[model samples]
Target: MKMLLTVEIPHEPFNSLVRGGKAGEIIGRILEAIKPEAVYFTEQDGMRCGVFLINVENPSDVPAFAEPFFLNFQANCKFRIVMSQEDLQKAGLEELGKKWA
Candidate 1:
């Protein structure tokens, strides 16, 4: 399934990584591992943040995806299932609406 991964890095570790010049290397390694379909980095709530779109084949794979951020940056990570337009269209909403209505 398609998932959106959001990572928020706390100030202390993030600043440390930036000062040590290891931020890019760490992020690069993560990107290489996940191979996300899309990724964007920005600030959120005044902290470093990343948004990634990826495919997760199994629920058990979440730990692998999340652990690096936790161990390296003490990041707060969240994942949400997402669907493309074609996937949404297949949800049978019309039938559900009729049944409920």
Candidate 2:
């Protein structure tokens, strides 16, 4: 399934990493390990954030996607399933609407 992984990293350790010029290196390592299909870095709620789109086979795979940030940055992570337009089109909504209507 396709999933969006949102990560918010607090200031303490992350600030330290930035000061030491290691922030990019750490982020690079995480990106290398997770291998996200698409990744973005931006700010959210006044914190540093990483947004990643990835595909996985099972919920158990959550740890592999999240643990690096958690242990290294004490980051807050969220996962959500997403569907493309093609997936939505194949959902059989018309058939369900006919029955429910």
Candidate 3:
């Protein structure tokens, strides 16, 4: 399934990496491992953040997606299931509404 991975990187470790000029290198390595469909850099609650869209095909694969950040940056990671338009269309919402209502 498609998942959204949100990473909030703390100031100390990331600042050290940036000061040492290794930030991009590590980030590139992590990105290569995850192979996200899309990634964006932004700030969340005053911390540097990364938002990624990726596909996790199995339940056990969740850590594989989030662990790079955890091991590398001690980053806080969150995973949320997401859907494309085609996925929404296949959700059977109308049928469920009839059944539930």
Tens digits of per-residue lDDT for model 2, 48-68: 999999997888999999999
Ranking by lDDT: 3, 1, 2
C-alpha RMSD of each candidate structure in angstroms: 0.7, 0.9, 0.7
lDDT of 2 at 95: 100
Lowest summed lDDT across 10 adjacent residues in model 3 is found at 63-72
lDDT of 1 at 1: 98
Error of 1 at 29 (Å): 0.5
User: How many steric clashes between backbone atoms does each model show?
Assistant: 0, 0, 0
Predictions in order: lDDT: 0.94, 0.94, 0.95
Using Cα atoms with residue i matched to residue i, what is each candidate's TM-score against the true structure? 0.96, 0.95, 0.97
TM-score of 2: 0.95
Model 3 misplaced regions, further than 4 Å: none
Candidate 1 per-residue lDDT, tens place, 1-101, comes to 99999999999787889999999999999999988999999999999899999899999999989999999999999999999999989999999999999
- TM-score-better candidate, 1 vs 2: 1
